[model samples]
Target: MTADMLIFFIFVLSIFLGFELISKVPSMLHTPLMSGTNAIHGIILLGGMLVLASAEGFIQHVAGFIAVVLGSANVFGGFMVTDRMLQMFKRKK
Candidate 1:
């Protein structure tokens, strides 16, 4: 198999594994899991930055820019949700 095809297969497998793992998480653990995933999503931002730097054409540039934007949004939203969840557990003075 070609390198690209191998990467694609791994990506598909990871998607399935990710879904299964997430689906099994208890509701009480979901916030912590999301918080962890948010840190992982930070890597997405780095990937986006790499793509943006290596972009060689208009289409590539646009796609890379979009990836950066979406990754940023996902990271931000995840942190916001996680923060809200943690706030619910805080002891009031």
Candidate 2:
């Protein structure tokens, strides 16, 4: 198989693996798990940047831009939710 095909297979496998792993976690652990995954979303943002950098057409540029924006929103929103959850544990002055 070609390298691209191999990578695509790996990517598909990881998506399924990730979904199964997350689905099995207890509800109480979901927030922490989501917070952890936010970092992985940052890696997605990097990938989007690389795609944008190498983009060769208007459609590619638009798609890359959209990917980067979505990744950014996911990372930011996840952290915001996590921070709010953490604050719930703090003692108010």
- Per lDDT, the best of the predicted structures is 1
Residues 5-31 of candidate 1 have per-residue lDDT tens digits of: 999999999999998877777687776
Worst 10 residues of 1 by lDDT: 34-43
- Can you give the lDDT of residue 43 in candidate 2? 65
The per-prediction tally of clashing pairs is 0, 0
Residue 38: error of model 1 in Å? 4.3
Error of 1 at 83 (Å): 0.7
In model 1, which runs have C-alpha deviations exceeding 4 angstroms? 1-27
**Can you give the lDDT of residue 2 in candidate 2?**
100
Reference-based TM-score, model 2: 0.60
Candidate 2: which stretches are off by over 4 Å? 1-29
C-alpha lDDT of all candidate models, in order: 0.84, 0.82
Q: Rate residue 77 of model 1 by lDDT.
A: 76
Local accuracy of candidate 2 as per-residue lDDT tens digits, 1-93: 999999999999998998887677878667776786774666678888899999988999999999999888777777777878767758877
